[model samples]
Target: MKINPPRQAQEWSYSSHQESIGEALSSPGIRSNKKTHINCGSSARMAGNVCANVDQIRRQGRWNNTTINDAYLTNLPRELVRSMAGFPTYCRFFYLARAILNPPTSLCKKLFPAIGE
Candidate 1:
């Protein structure tokens, strides 16, 4: 079935490049090492690159007290952290399920016709 034009437009608008970058930077789970910096080509690349650097630090047993965790996580809004955590591959399906099971009526009706079927 075809989606409404306005709703389709809204979805497209929400998933823009800027939004993705914002999501990555604002995520609470991302930990960065202050002493050793990874030079990502741009601000956009820094987020993923930081994670990779953390992995490298982990492999060499160099991740000292700089590891990211809930302590620093509290600096970000809880809701935003929750949203970021939901992006992991393992959590995506569960996130979608939760959204479907308890969505606002307007979104539920618009996204899932079966809800009104």
Candidate 2:
């Protein structure tokens, strides 16, 4: 089987919500509370929840705007593309190709590496 490489590296940035969560977590006096916040959900938590949705969408091929080709190959950064290309064909095809073709939202990318992979 022939394997094609991704054209570019997928780049994503942290949402404001995510930044807030990191700030909360990394704050000096904040206690480590494992419980999910009842009122204001943390950015990391929200991101994790959204990632689950993205994975479901990808596996089922249910994203409204996503095309088959989009799910197969992503436009990752040059460095990432090179790294992915070094992996086995099937891995590259499924991970890089599917990710690019599907192109997850920024939230999904931050929450789930698998979704962005």
Relative to the true structure, candidate 1 has a C-alpha RMSD (angstroms) of 17.0
Residue 104's C-alpha lDDT in candidate 2?
47
Q: What tens digits encode model 1's per-residue C-alpha lDDT throughout 1-117?
A: 222334544554544534444445447555444212322223223332334343453444433434433211123443455567674433223344545666579997888878876
Q: Give TM per candidate.
A: 0.19, 0.18
- Name the regions of candidate 1 deviating beyond 4 angstroms: 1-36, 39-57, 67-94, 101-117
> What is candidate 2's CA lDDT for residue 77?
39
- Where is the poorest 10-residue window by lDDT in model 1? 35-44
lDDT (0 to 1) per candidate: 0.42, 0.42
TM-score of 1: 0.19
